[model samples]
Target chain A: MTAAALSLSKIVAGHDGHVSISDVTLAVPAGARVAVIGANGAGKSTLLKTIAGELPPLGGQMRRCATCARMGYLPQSATVDTRFPVSVYEFVAMGVWNHVGLFRRLGPAVRQRIDAALDRTGLAALARRPIGALSGGQLQRARFARLMLQDAALLLLDEPFAGVDRPTREALMALIDGWHAEGRTCLVVLHDLDLVRQRFEWCLSVDDGHAQLTPTAELLALRPTADGAAAARHAFLRDALRA
Target chain B: MSWLLDPFDFAFMRGALAACVALSLGAAPVGVFMLLRRMSLMGDAISHAILPGAALGYLAAGLSLGAMTLGGVAAGVLVALAAGLVARRSALREDASLAAFYLISLAIGVLLVSLKSRNIDLLHVLFGSVLSLDRDALLLIAGIATASLFGLAALYRPLVIECADPDYLRQAGGPGALVHLGFLLLAVLNLVAGFHALGTLMAVGIMVLPAASARLLCERLDSMLALAVGNALAGSIGGLLLSYHLDVPAGPAVVLSLGLIYVVVLAFTALRPRPILTSEVTA
Candidate 1:
């Protein structure tokens, strides 16, 4: 078997000793476009954060191939404070800090890469504006621009399409498709099951603090039937009407 | 020209002006970071916390600059660390813990002052004698300003990244904790330096007010920094002149001048008509 891009065995992850996901064992093949799906508060984000090394696993063994050394993570948009006085260009330039480190000058080549990333993400013209002033979609695009500059072998996205419009979502999905074509490993946390089935080959279903990894078709088959889904929709509408 | 040149005619006046300029240059930039981080009151708390240390130094070695600065830095760092610990370990929020610690520190400082020092010395500690600054005080202010400028330059990128998104910085392998502690140390250093000219009670006034005023006028970070420093310098010069002519206290005069600038800026912006839709086409 080809070496797995990422492998986690019996992992327990969360913050401050409160484990959100427990006993998660899975291995993702290299170049797989995997979708992580679950209801709200199901620890999907916690799993992604652990894989990205943002949160340490309480108990687990995680191994990554040498080719997957460079990993990029895009946290949910709500986690960033847009009120800070950073320009789009300056914020995107931070993606290069891992390579350049502190005190290294942004030479011509680095500047070119930053500019190219901004241009590709459609943020070149708004480069000088403060991030606080940008709309939500624009800010998400700027974040994508920063991710483009990362140029990682593995990418982890948490709610990447949350609160985004259709065109912007399509544009972002196209970028991910390009990354997939280049054989980069991607694990995306998403809510739309249809989109996941359409785009991803594998699915990791997280529910009740456990994760089940399966092919997308198999996972879709395990989802609730049409009558159950309709009942869930009706219950949701009733709650909304009562509110 | 005479109005400008007259303040420098006397050695004492020149020394006072130099002290003000040095304090402004060093403390204002740190103040900008404090404002951006929404820790403006933390500066106030640390300034108060310095008082007990200064009092201890006075008790040990009377009116010694090195001793008092050392004492103040130690006390400030202790309070910061303790408050941070309490906030992290307990249910109390950081600001609430800071308030509690600083109040206790202030009471202790006052008790220490009453126990050992005379009223004349207490007055000096409460309100600095800017016009009577000796060469030692002048050197201390200049040295701190120079060091702080270099320190800020070195920590600028990490500090900004940490403020923007600390988790992202950590994921990118930047030293977030080191940058945070270094920034706190710099803040304490600048506050100690300001105490020589503005005194512990009023030192934070000089640091925060000028930065606050500049925020209303400038939109970019670099511009805001430059404007804050400029506003501080202007307030210092204007306050010194006012104290000379009107015979008011110099420290409050300087801080009040900054406050006046803020009010004026507020009024000016309020009167100006705002644009309805300022968004422009990008590309």
Candidate 2:
């Protein structure tokens, strides 16, 4: 078996010392496509944030392979202020910052790389247009173009397809498929269960501060029916009150 | 031609024009970021907060440039830090905290100025004597403009990323907080530079108006920056000429000229009905 890309032991994660997800223990193997799925406020994003190093684990241990140097993170679209006067190319070129940094010159090679990424993400034509001019789907495409430039080993995508159009969604998924084929590790936070079941091999379900990592097939089989969902909610309330 | 050429005949008018132009080069670019970040009021807040420190410096050294600038920068930075902390730690928002702090600072500054100096001297502090700018003041203004322009160029990338998407910058290993603080320091430095030429009351006006007007005129950041600098220089020169010819305060004249430009652009843009290409993403 390939070496584990990420190892988490009894991890608790959240912001400002408040635990959002507790006891999350899992080992994501190399090239694994893992979907993090949960209801609202179920700590799905919090878990991804921890894995992406945006938030510290409130408790527990986590490790990644030393080779996983470049980790690309696509935060929720709400985090970006689109009104800022930046062109699509300029916004996407920011991904090269890890390599070129602040002071280094962006030579012809770097420019070509940025152009390639923009072309791949279907944003080549909009390269000179301001980012604020792009629609929701186009904006998401621009962000993906940026991530493509990053070329990270581990990709953490938070709602990458959220609010995107069908064509854009398919294009983004194709990009992810390409990444997975390249043996990259992907931890995706997704709301569309159908898409997750079809695309992902592993599923991590978070609910009421508890997380369970299981195979996608097994989790889909165990998914609650309408009556079961209600019962589950009741049990969840009981467990919470008892805690 | 003589109407324009006549102002340079008087050395003081030339000094005033030079001072205004130098102040614009630094403050206008800083104003671009300020407008983009929706921190326009922060400039006003920092300018007001600098008053107490300027007053204290005046009390200690009596019209010494270095002493007053140091005090103003120290006070502006302190208030910015405090206001940031208060906003983060408490229920009040950043704007509210900044407003509260600046009001108290302004009151204290006015009180301190009144304690030792007459109203006329206080007026000089409140509204700068641009025409009477000495050699030291001219040097300070030029130095600040050079430093600020260099700093802005160096920090351009990180500052833009920080303003647009701070979380992404942080996650990508960019120093977001440091960029923010660096920008704040530049803002304070430029405000101090402006204070020397335009006074605390009118300094932010020259920075904000030109940038805001530039925003209406340009869609790209680079274009906006260029236009803002151009507008600032034009406004300053125009205001100097207006002040020389009409016997008005140079600082307010400069600001009013900028406002007039903005109003004209606003009217022109309205008449043409240009399609606004930018659309803000709903958070």
Give the top-scoring candidate (lDDT): 2
The positional error of residue A103 in candidate 2, measured at the CA in angstroms, is 1.9
| Highest TM-score scorer | 2
User: How far is B136's C-alpha from truth in model 1 (Å)?
Assistant: 1.5
Q: TM-score, each model?
A: 0.93, 0.94
DockQ of each: 0.35, 0.54
Instruction: Count backbone clashes in candidate 1.
Output: 0
Q: Write the per-residue lDDT of candidate 1 for residues B1-283, one digit (tens) a residue.
A: 7877886899999999999999889999989988888878888889999999989998899889888989999998888788889999999999999899889988998888889878877777777778889999999999999999999999998888887776778776689889989999999999998887888788887788889888777767889899889989998888998888798988778888878887888898788785332233321
Show where candidate 2 strays beyond 4 Å. Answer: A217-243, B276-283
| Cα-based lDDT at residue B204, candidate 1 | 87
